[model samples]
Target: MQATKKATINIALVGNPNSGKSSLFNALTGLNQKVSNFPGVTVDKKTGAASISPTLQANIIDLPGTYSLYPKSADEFVTYDVLVNPSGDEQPDMVLIIADASNLKRNLLFCSQIMDLKIPVIIGLTMMDIARKKGVEIDEAGLERELGVPIVTINPRKNKGVSELKKMIDLVAKEKQSVAPRDFIDSAALAPEVVRDIRQYVQVKSDYAALHVAVNHGELPFLNGGQKLAITNLLQANQFNKTKVQAEEIMQRYGRIKHIMKNTVVEADPLQKQLQTEKLDNILLHRFWGYVILLSIMFVMFQSIFWLASFPMDWIEAGFGALSGWLTNILPANQLTDILVNGVIAGLGGIAVFVPQIMILFAFITVLEDTGYMARISFLTDRLMRQVGLNGKSVMPLISGVACAVPAIMATRNIENRKERLITILITPLMSCSARLPIYTVMIALVIPNKLIFGFFNLQGLVMMGLYLLGFVMALLIAALLKLFISIKEKSYFIMELPVYRAPRWANVGTTMVQKAKIFITDAGKVIMIISIILWFLASFGPKDRMEKVTAHYEQLKTAHPEQSEALDMELQSEKLSNSYAGVLGHAIEPVIRPLGYDWKIGIAVITSFAAREVFVGTMATLYSVGESPEDNDATLREKMRNATWRDGSPVYTLASGVSLMLFYAFAMQCMSTLAIVKRETKSWKLPAIQFAYMTVLAYISAFIAFELLK
Candidate 1:
């Protein structure tokens, strides 16, 4: 007889937050995953391929962690929809339920829920070491018998028992998975009439799945208008109370889980390891010392961004400079050559030069998260956050804004209250993101002196830290002001689980840094290059008559004095750029920005940088490169900006103007990506429109004040 066919199947990793689910996923599908948003949602979906055996393979889906089937946030909505009614690529054929053995009781609640969906499931036990340290012993075979599913203990961090888990996965996949085991809790008992009615009204997989349909049929992506209406009618006719049903469901599941644990697990006095976790928390969570340590840590992180990265940043800048010079000397001189050397390469240089700093920043953030310190930050600031109409949950998104606003805004899904979430999304962009790092560093280098203070602290680093603090401070103030308006009010709570402190996973930190670097160099680089090319066209050519007139005027001078050919040619290029199409556009806004200590060239950069904040650097590079000769290719962007002058030949980028530019970016809604995510998250154009207007006003007023006072 022919062997049965072994087709690739889907295996979703599902669990509660901090359950080590993602860690196991990383181990199983190392360097094989890609991230994309789930269909019709902004939430990220991480999928990877895993080989279960020589002839068997499965696609792995890492779902967002949730406590239970009933969801309260947008993130949870994605998890629920996928587990209950997956669509397209998200369909789950078999599931690996990642459960924390150390917190097995709480973990079983989610595991039981996923099983009731009638899908095949295997419980991959994690944190067994931590469980043993707590003097808790569990019979895996006994628990497996009681749960009626295969159980495998795994430590993805140390690569323990992973092969056994994969063997179980292969065994499960080879079997026909059409029939599921008995329900952990008889779902018919929850609301028999309503469940039956919905089950009849719509063909669902199980009774519990029908109950979810009754509870949230309207929001489920798969249900159509007719089906949703029918379910709604059934729910109303039965007078179903969603809150009561949800609460009762949790109580019944826990009761069963407690019984299962008591029969199969034994406990004694916890070892000193558990005690150490508590001891560390005492110091890290101490009110006074916690705040001080947090500030000190932040100060060092920001300082290291500049200090540790300076060497690599300079090397990258110099490499680009040398490449541009070599290309200019060898490549044919024409419009294409000009675009290649100036537009593409210069834009690329602007993006690459700051990657070291971006990597350092992401590395610091990732370490904080992996060490479990990030959660404590939220706890420590919960009260202060409450004063501004936010809670601890809002702090994560705000802090994440330091890396990028798009994901930070998406992070607001954790904020349960509508008003607080919206407020958090609106102010998140005010926190300096990595995209702003280039602008800040360039401006800071030009204006702030690089000197050490008190023999240890760096002056430039202090200014950098101050700028970050300013972003956080301004975000809180804006949240306070926004709270006074917007009448949607609701009760808010900050319920968080502080995980046990462990040393950071350096591998994870390194992976994050590499991913962020690739994203900046590729995704951000593409946008900057495109904009630079467009800007180059406008800056290099002009109204035919004016361009020709300038060329003719410079030609006559060069002829009159052949010995001054090089100098005259330089003047000629500058004159032509001043009369070009870009010059006209910049001049159009020059009047409005003049009082803020900006020239026409600065005006052009400001207008074009609305595409993204980092585009400011490329814009400056392209703008400055237009008037420079091939012999001047070695000059760095900072050097070019330093040499910039107004029409009167007076320096344009003085102390007042450089600070004014930095402050403008610190407050401006210059990233269309951030604004777009805000609209998507809020599902409203009005909020983003309002956000743009208010931020523009704030930027102008703040920059005007800075320039006026400093001047």
Candidate 2:
């Protein structure tokens, strides 16, 4: 008997937003997934391996969620490019199209488009419970016959029907058959002569691919210059009008869909009462109550970050401090010991201690997104967004900015209006991201009293909320001002589908929280460690002659007054730091930042943190640990910072200085990653340069005003 052959098959999972596609991917791949960027694009490409059989395995590629094949953004363009160009790297052997059973008509639009590509396709009907709740039932067998593809109803969140779905996928992969149902649209009539000409020039799988080549031949990556010119000339010669063809094709496809729905789908009533989603929205999306609820939610989220995560944060800080002291005691007195204890351990501890807060923030965000409340947030803020010259869709990116601005800026690609998209990108960094949390928490702890207001609300928590609100308010004001300068003729609209509210998936939330924390430790931790080592070197050694003279001077003082030896030792260390390379750089910039109530030490942190905002905490940890004795090594970073004083015997972290620094970070565009992403998204340095210039000016002016007023 011949041995069974083993092979790898590529399966593409495509779906609309909120269609449970990602959930299915997670169920299938579990911990086997890897996320990277698509070639030459910043759009995320998530792929994973799933074993279908003992000898057979499938590589699942989770394509970005898009409405249809018509590309509107860079992300959609990726999906369109892969589907049309069957010979590309991402070309699929079979397609698993996830359809929301609750809204099959709209979901099937894209499904039908996929079928027309002549790929081997299977439909995974998700959200069955949601469909039943809405009093809708789908005849899966009849619908399968109508669409001419295998259909399986799966609930990945509950692991129901997942094995059956896997069996179907394995069967389809082994069969290697293409299911091109001819029920959707008459592709030949859409572009007859043009399609015929394109098929002669390229290996077209179906007439739909031919039509796409004719319409998009100029930008298609598969077509060379000669083929592109030939197709372009052929299209012009045949009088192929793309817009007219697209409209006709959509209308014709929907007409057929209407007929299919009548035969294979059933609904209880067209004039049914309000949906559960609608009832909830009545309260959550109310004009007056919505704003109040939104603010309350924001307050609670910030409050929880401080209140809930404090114990874990304190534990982490205490653990690191103990470890540092232990290492200090064991290690010999040398430069290596100082580098290991003061630089590596201290820097890592500073950022790692904040992991609990970051995890909690991400968990809350995940719950909001998964429960469908995030969409209503957009709906609630649409009017206010329009007042700021943005549409409702901009709210997603703006809210996402609270986590990170790089992906938030990428999210702006979905906005069709150029002027609105640009404005959103410009203002998104103002949203206090997780990176800023470390700085804010550290500063607030040092300056703001840990007291309660009204015997309930924590004052420090309230200040944190106020900082977030200030960022949001400034974003709006800046956008409104920018709107006057940017002019465009296109009209903008926000058409979003609000998914039904469901119980928060605890597993998914946990996964997200862990993943976000891991990313911070792995990505930001590397930068912190490298900079810490370099900073230790810069702070440890000065010019050879200056160091010798300082040592000699300190020795003479110790000889004269042995009782003052310990006090004089600290003074000698401080004097050496003033002459060190890091200190010199800080002193150079101190003059400019002095008016804002920042000393030279803060000046160093401000300059170093431009690489990333979170590095400010790490910088502080390394700087503070450098001159401290071994006995004081066990103090937490907050305590160390609280005890810091300026030359005039004033607290360095005074309320005025803390507020000034917070305001500076709130408005400043210090993140290099954000700026790089902006350049990539806009495809120009002009916008990033302008962004940097304006944000720096705004940060300085805001800090100056805050310090002056508060002091």
User: Which candidate should be chosen as best, given lDDT against the real structure?
Assistant: 2
Q: Write the per-residue lDDT of candidate 1 for residues 1-711, one digit (tens) a residue.
A: 987565688888889998888889988898899998999987888999988888787899998889988888888888888888834458798888899998888889999998888888998999998888788899999998888888899998889989999988888878845234788888888899998888776667889898888888888878888888877887888888998998888889999998999999997655445467888888888989989999999989988988999999999999999999999989999888899888888888977899999999999999999889999999999999999999999999989999999888888887889999989988999999999999999999988999989988988889888888988999999999999997997999789878878899898899999999999888888899899999899999999999999999988999999999989988988888889999888888899999999999889989888898899899989989987988887789999989988878988998899889888999999988888888888788999999999999999999999999999
List where candidate 2 sits over 4 angstroms from the true fold: 1-5, 181-183
Could you report the Cα RMSD, in angstroms, for every candidate shown? 2.7, 2.0
| Candidate 2 lDDT over residue span 556-671, tens digit each | 99999999999998888888888788888888999999999998888898888998999999999999899787888888899989888888778888989999999999999989
Looking at model 2, residue 87 earns an lDDT score of: 81
Instruction: List the candidate 1 regions with Cα displacement exceeding 4 Å.
Output: 1-5, 86-91, 176-181, 221-239, 270-274, 330-337, 555-567
Where is model 2 poorest over a 10-residue stretch in terms of lDDT?
A: 175-184
Which candidate achieves the best TM-score against the true structure? 2
Per-prediction TM-score to the true structure, in the order listed? 0.93, 0.96
- As a whole number from 0 to 100, the lDDT of residue 324 in candidate 1 is 93
Candidate 1, clashing residue pairs? none
